[model samples]
Target: MTAVPVFLYHAVSDNPPRWLAPFTVSPRTFVEHLNMIADSGLRVVPLRQLVTTLLGGPPLPPRSAVLTFDDGYADFASTVAPLLAGRGLPATLYVTTGALHASGTPSGRGPFPSAATLSWGQLRELDAAGFEIGGHTKTHPQLDTLPRTSVREEVGGCKREIEDALGHPVDSFAYPHGYSSRTVRTLVWETGWTSAAAVRGPSALSSNRDDPLRFARLMVRADTDRKRFELWAQGEGAPVAPFAEGLRTRGWRAYRRARAVTGHPYRALPTDEG
Candidate 1:
């Protein structure tokens, strides 16, 4: 079983909102992680390469890893992109379309907390710069907990919004807060998404056998210390994906759905926080 670390990141900044701080990594630490990946001889490949392999197109080069960022934070344009461009690395950035800052207002109403998010112009620039821009829903909502109609709107509507903005089709989608059920995944595929990202909790690495629509990702957070990250880079600390969804996951989903029905759904937070 060849393990591929599809590293997930959020905001990369020294100063982040209190709510986002747990998921944020400082620029210095981000550089260190990149350097460590290079030192370990692991190649950072574009996410589509891994997706192609998962789709049975071809085998990935040995020791290949992926870089993906969820939620379009302003720091991605201001800090993360320059660093990645400097290293000549490829990455995929999934943006919550509604949360994007445009003019003096958000493009749409998103469920995310108050923070500096990427604007549409910045996203276009990032796309032009060779960064793969993917969809993270119009408003960041838990897809599994929403009604089927709403799921379609969120899943398909987001693809349309990004395509309208970018003037090209985007193939990748990521579940908000890493929550997705079978229904949600089906909706995503019906909406024409080729690959979708999900957090398989901590210590799980995506592999060739992982589901293209619900591939696992190893989240890199503020608390992800050097030792743990190094181990992940070596594919030694995490279990490879394509595992069965356990009873605990189903129970958690039930609880969240119940909360949603009561109009008191869980607030958006890092995937591990729930």
Candidate 2:
């Protein structure tokens, strides 16, 4: 069975704020990426549909792939959605509800930069336009560091909020910072989400047999050139899995230990590392 690549993005802008500039892709680059996928004869499907096909609902199309964006950045509505709409592609947007209400401000005293989270109005428009909106917790926090109760609130609360705002069910989730432990996974499952996405680590699932909860995604940052992006689109980007996982595992442990000492689940600073 051939694995489908789930491409992950954060913001789409040529003039991204200082802190998030690394993760943000220019609009031209985004368009090029979309064109690459379309020209590759690959089908760009919704993440939920991809999951269903992977789980036995239907045989996936040849070279099926998924696009997902995290944090519900304003650029998603302004930039990403337009390009996706033009391509007739579907994507999943995972929102941190707290940020939506926080106005145009960075959540903490870090240089994370000030940007507007998507408004309720914008989210509703996206839902109406055939995009899936998933939960990324009430506030973007490291789920592994929080107690189970807080984890439940963060995960469950965000789902309920999106449902209330959109008048539809949210069936998917993506871990903030791509961090989750077994307990966190269980909490997400109990909250009624059918699937969840994580950034980095291993390559994407080669078949339906892979775990649904820990679905791996290829993090596409600003620096991803056309050659590397093509490698990913063609599903030939797994050559560096061992090296990538090694770095991810070490960074995850260090963050876990640091959070343990600070008793803080939320990160105050923006990072170049995904």
Candidate 3:
């Protein structure tokens, strides 16, 4: 019962916005991390391939893994894509449709910094380059707190928007902030997406027995040094590393859920609170 590890990333920039600092991995560190991946002997595959194989499409080669980027940041095009292109590596970029229309501002607590959303042209280029363009909803909402109809719009509408823009099918979906509910998962599947992504730190695993809609992704943050990155890449530090963070993510989600039930009204989506 081997499990494939999927690495989740946000922005790659030398100077990440104060609000996004925790998730930002500088280009230098990203390059180092890629170098390590190249030297690690693991085969990096696209998110589609992983989901396909997991769904009984075909067997994958040994030591297989997937790389995915959430929130369509402009830095991905300006910085990350070129590096991946040079390496001939394919990754999935989940886009939030509403953010692309933003005023190109930088460093904010919004779904993306003003300048973070990639332009439609860039997204198409990425698609043309064999990268997967998935949906991250229209406005990057927290699916669990929304009504089923609203969730459908968030999931289905975003898929339709991306597919229309790229003139291709958008089969992958990622929940904003790695938060989702069973209802949310069902809506994702019902929306015609083949798979969806979630984060539960190292606690998440993508084995044949795992749910495709709830595919687990390990976060790669700014603080992930070479040593820690290597351990994560090799699937060695799941218990200790992600578990520590998982306690917090899990606890927060629980708190949000309770608030939702009490009609106290949590944020409609995640925000980088100071």
lDDT of each: 0.89, 0.76, 0.76
Model 1 weakest 10-residue run by lDDT: 103-112
Query: Each model's TM-score?
Result: 0.96, 0.87, 0.87
Q: On a 0 to 1 TM-score scale, where does candidate 3 land against the true structure?
A: 0.87
What is the per-residue lDDT of model 1 for residues 118-198, given as tens digits with 9 covering 90 to 100?
A: 888898999999999999998888889999999999889989999999999999999988889999999899899999999
- How many clashes in each candidate? 0, 0, 3
Flag regions of model 3 displaced more than 4 Å: 102-110, 202-205, 239-254, 260-274
What TM-score number comes out for model 2? 0.87
* lDDT (10s digit) by residue, model 2, range 1-274: 5667888888888777787877788888988898898888778877877678646687677688889898877889888888888878889998888777433434332122376567777888899998899988886777777878999999999999999998978899998878777788899999999998875453343334445676777778877888988988888765322123466676775777577768764453322233
Say which candidate scores most in TM-score. Answer: 1
| lDDT of candidate 2 at residue 100, scale 0 to 100 | 73
Q: After aligning candidate 3 to the native by TM-score, how far in Å is the CA of 209 from where it should be? A: 3.2
Which stretches in model 2 have alpha-carbon errors above 4 Å? 102-113, 202-207, 239-251, 264-274
Error of 2 at 227 (Å): 1.0
Q: What's model 3's lDDT at 76?
A: 87
- Against the hidden true structure, what lDDT does model 1 obtain? 0.89
* Model 2 worst lDDT window (10 residues): 103-112
Model 2 clash pairs are none
